[model samples]
Target: MNVMVAEHIGFCFGVMRALNIAKKTKERTDKPVFTLGPLIHNPQAVHELEELGIHPINSLDEAPGGILIIRSHGVPPDVIEKAKEKGFEIVDATCPFVKRVQEYARKLCEEGYRVIVVGEENHPEVIGIIGHTGGKAEAMNKRRIPVIEDRDRIGMVAQTTQSIENLKLAISYVVERVKELKVYNTICNATYMRQQSTKLLAKEVDLMLVVGGKMSANTSRLVEIARNEGCETYHIETKEDIDPAWFSGKITVGVASGTSTPDWVIKDVVEYIKNL
Candidate 1:
């Protein structure tokens, strides 16, 4: 089996920063550490953190103990407040890029612009961004831009993982009609590089494997890109999940991982395929 790995596989700057902050904070603090959700989507990584006494909790209602670590995607403001009120010191690991989107969305809403969060609804990042806009932020993600005929002032902010091409298409959909248009090109540079490199890799390989947390949006996007190239694609969280049958006949295999993925997981997956 011939295996080729993406040039950009594994942790991007944001995920690295979040992990470092969480780890460093955990090392220093005695208070039990908890993330509002999985710090990154990889169970192995989460389990490692758990070994160090860090845990991920699903809801604020369930979290009345320990220091609360905000995931890479910023939590809702109310969650933060409730955490603080509940006597949990907050270690915010929300990516700066995502924080910027929240700020921009809040600013746009304050200025009376009809805010549109050009991203997935219910995603932690999008949820935080929308909360900033008082829930007026309509989702224009995944090639689904709606008809906007009446808003005099329209503003757009993208989900950090969204592709540049999709962002442009969404903005273009609204540019001509709205008298005032505000676009904060919030697509993080890490996302763009990963997206471009993944697409190129997809074209060159017979089959593609995207590795990351199943809950991770960016990893899912990589799978979509490979599928768009008309190649067989699989989205796996780790080596154990890989089906040998998928690569049974393919000579060339390409592997790409999401920003949140760790390098070791990708390496293990690639090595498994090569050994097969």
Candidate 2:
């Protein structure tokens, strides 16, 4: 069997930047370093950081005082202010792309347009973006389009990891429902490239493997994309999740991973396939 890897695989610029900032903060700080949430979506990567003395805390109350490194998913402005009030030193590691989405959302809200974020409502990134609008923005997925009045001015920005197709659907739904519509394509360029590469590779391969954290939205989307292309696809976080039975009679395997996935994890998956 041959293994074909996607052209765009593993960590994107944002994830790498967040990880770098976390590592540097650990190296320089004597105080306990904490992230309000998992620094990134990858559990393995988060575990590695814990080994280096950077830990994830669920809430500010959990930490008495220390350096708080914001995850790649930007948080609301109020959260930063509250963290300051709690005496925690803030080290923002928000991805520039995500920050842009938040800025657009805030701008739209200030300009008298109803802000709608195109992504899962419960997602940390989406939640953070909504907070930027002072809790005025509502998050909507393709399946759950927000109701808009005919007289309403609608302004839309998508979660950075959102698929283009979903964004388009949301835009189409809102445009007809509102009098004036403004939309920003906030999907990350790297995500689009990865999805496109995975779709193209799935067509030629007998089996497709997506590697990344199960909690990663981008990774889940890759799995969905490959499966939608009619290829047999399995999402795995590590080599241990691989089932040899799935490879039976398969001649070519295509491998793709989420932006949060690390190179070492992808390398391990590729090596395992080569050995098989």
Candidate 3:
């Protein structure tokens, strides 16, 4: 069997910047270093940071006083203020793309538009973006377009990892129902590249393998895209998740990974496939 890898796979600029900030913070601080959340979506990467003395904490109460690194997903401005009030040093590692979305949401809210965040409601990034709107904004997916009255003016911003198709669909749903609509295309360029590359590769391969953390939204999006292309696709975090049975009678295997995925993880998956 032959192996084909997507042109755009593995860590993007934002994830790399966050990882570097975490590592440097660890090197500089003796006070326990803790990320407000997993520094990135990848468990393996977070585990590696723990080994280097950087830990992930879900809440500020978990640490009495320590350096708090904001994950790439970005947190609410209030979160940073609270961490400061608790005497924790702050290292903001939020992705620039996500930061832009939050800013746009805040601006939209300040301008009196009914803010609609186009993304998963429960996602940390979406939560942070809503917070920027001072809790006035609502998050919605393609399946759940929020109710907008004909008199309501709507302002929209999407999760950086959101698919373009879903964003477009949500916009279409809102435009006809509202008095006016303003949208900021906040999806990351890297996300578009990765999704497009995965789609192209999936069309030419017999089997498609997506590697990244299970909780990674971008990774899951790739799996959805590949499956929609009618290719047999499996999402895995590591080589251990690979099943030889899936490769039976397969000629060409395509490999794609989320932006949070490290190069080493992708290399390991590719090596395992070559051996198989």
Candidate 4:
């Protein structure tokens, strides 16, 4: 079997920065370090961090006195304030792109534009961004953008991991109805590159393997993109999830992983396919 890897795969800059901050803090401090949430979407990466003495605590109350590193997904400002009130030293590892979206959304809200965040409603990133707006923003998925009120001005921002196509479509939904539509294309460049690369690679391979956490939004998006290109795609977290039967009659396989996926996991998936 010929195994082809996407031009862009594995950890992106944002995930790498978060991991570095967590690992370095673990190495330098005697204080127990806790992440406000899973540092990234990849479970294997979080487990590895745990092995290195960096723990993930879901809530501020769960953390003992120590440094609290905010995950790359970012959190609402109130979360930082509450953690500070609890006396935990904070290290914010929010992706710069995500922070930009939050800032724009907040500014839009303050300027009196109805804020519309284009992303999954329940996604941590979207929730965090909405918090910046004092919980006054609306998060919607690609299928529908809810019409809460007819307004003259509306501002739109996207979750950093959202597809550019989705952002554009969501903007189109509001463009005509609203007298003035403001939008910030806050989708990370790396995300666009990866999605495009995945689409291009998917067309050349018989079977497409998307290796990342099942909960990873970007990884799921990659699977959707591959399938949209008329290719059979599987989203797997590890080599163990690879089904040998799926490789039957497949001459060429394409491998693509999400931004949060570690290089080691990608290598294992690739090597497993080679052996098959």
Candidate 5:
């Protein structure tokens, strides 16, 4: 059997940056370091951090007082204010591309364009993008994208991990109803590359294996993309999760991973598939 791997699988710049910051924070202080959420979407990575005494807490109320690491998915501004009020040291790891979305959304709101965020409504990145719009942002999920609202002007931005095609579709939907429309293609470059590479590999392979945390938005999207292309795709967290039955009679396989995925995980999966 043949195994094809994506050219752009594994950690992106933003995720790497966030992880590095987390490691340095762990080394610099003895105080408890807590992440607002999993610093990255990968469970293995989170477990690795936990081993280093970096913990993930869901709420600000449960956070420790030492150092709070804001995830790559930027949090609301009020969180920053409140964290500071509690005297917790802040280590921001927000991706620059995400910050760009926030900037565009804020600008649109100030100029009177109804801020339209084209992505999942409750995604952490989507939440952060909305917070930047001064409460004027309206998030359009997969369901909401179809219903064009009654608005004169609309400004658009997407969650960095979303497919560009979805953003364009939402833009097309709004073009007719809104007198003026603006779009910031906020989909991260790495994400687009990963999607494109995955699609290319999926077409040639007999089966597809996607590796990353199930909770990861980008990883889940990869599973959906591969399956939508008519390929038999399985999303797995580790090599142990692979089903041998799924590989029966398959001559070629394609593998791809999310941004938070580690190179070692990909290597291990590739080896496992090759041996089958």
Candidate 6:
């Protein structure tokens, strides 16, 4: 069997930046360094950071002092404020694209337009964006936009990882409901390229393997996109999750990974496929 891998198969710019910041902090200080959440969605990456003395804690209350690295997903302004109040040194590692969305949401709210964030309601990125809007914005995953008040103006921004298809559908639903609508395409360039590459690969290969953490929203979306293209796709975090039997009768296969995925994980999975 022949195997192909997506051209963009590992950590994107934002994830790389966040990891570098964490690693640099570890190099300089003996103090406890805690991340607001998993530095990135990949478990292996987070585990690697832990080995270097960087820890992931869910709440600010749990971190007593030292440096706090905000995850790539970014946190609300208030989260940073609270951390500062507690005397923790802050490393803002929020993806620049996500920060753009938050700023757009805040601008829309200030301009008197009802803001709508187009993405998973429970996603940290979406929640962070909403916090920028002072917790008054609405978050909708698909077409389930809430009944709007008598507001005529509406502004929409998407979670940085959302697929264009999902963003467009959400916008279509809101377009009919509001009179004056503003839409900002906040999906990062890296994400858009990865989605396109994954879709293209799926059509050319007999089977597809998407590698990344299950908790990664973007990784799950890649699997969904491959399946939606009618290709047999499996989402796996590591080479151990691969089933040799799945490769039976397949002449060609393709591998793609989420932005948070590390280069070593992809190389291992690809090597395993070649050895099979």
Model 4: per-residue Cα lDDT at residue 134 = 99
lDDT of each: 0.86, 0.94, 0.93, 0.91, 0.89, 0.92
Note the clash tally of each candidate. 0, 0, 0, 0, 0, 0
How well is each residue in 1-276 modelled by candidate 5, as lDDT tens digits? Answer: 799997789999999999999999999998999999999999899999999999999988896487999999998888888999988899999988888889999999999888889888878999888888767798986687645566667888888998877887788788978678888888999999999898888888999999999889998888888887899999999999998999888899999999999888889999998888
Reference-based TM-score of each model: 0.94, 0.98, 0.98, 0.97, 0.97, 0.97
lDDT of 2 by residue, 1-276 (tens): 799999999899999999999999989979999998999999999999999999999899999989999999988888899999999999999999999999999999999999999999989999999999989999999667677899999999999888888888898888878779999999999999999999999999999999999999999999999999999999999999999999999999999999999899999999999999
RMSD each, Å: 1.6, 1.0, 0.9, 1.2, 1.3, 1.2
Q: What would the per-residue lDDT of candidate 6 be over residues 1-276, giving only the tens digit for each residue?
A: 699998777999999999999999889998899999899999999999999999999998997989999988988899999999999999899988889999999999999988888888888999899999989889988545677654678888888889999999888877877678999999999998999999999999999999999999999999999999999999999999999999999999999999999999999999999999
Kindly provide the TM-score of model 3 when superposed on the true structure, using C-alpha atoms. 0.98
lDDT per residue as tens, model 4, 1-276: 899999999899999999999999889999999998799999999999999999999888896779999988999999999999999999999989889999999999999988999999888999999999999999978565687445568888988888887887888778868678889888888888999999999999999999999999999999999999999999999999988999999999999999999999999999989988
Model 1 alpha-carbon drift over 4 Å, by segment: 142-145
TM-score of 5: 0.97
Please identify model 6 stretches exceeding 4 Å from their true place: 149-151
Once superposed on the true structure, which residue ranges of model 3 sit more than 4 Å away at CA?
none
Candidate achieving higher lDDT, 1 or 5: 5
Alpha-carbon runs more than 4 Å astray in model 5: 146-151
Query: Candidate 2 clashing pairs?
Result: none
Cα error of candidate 3 at position 82, Å: 1.3
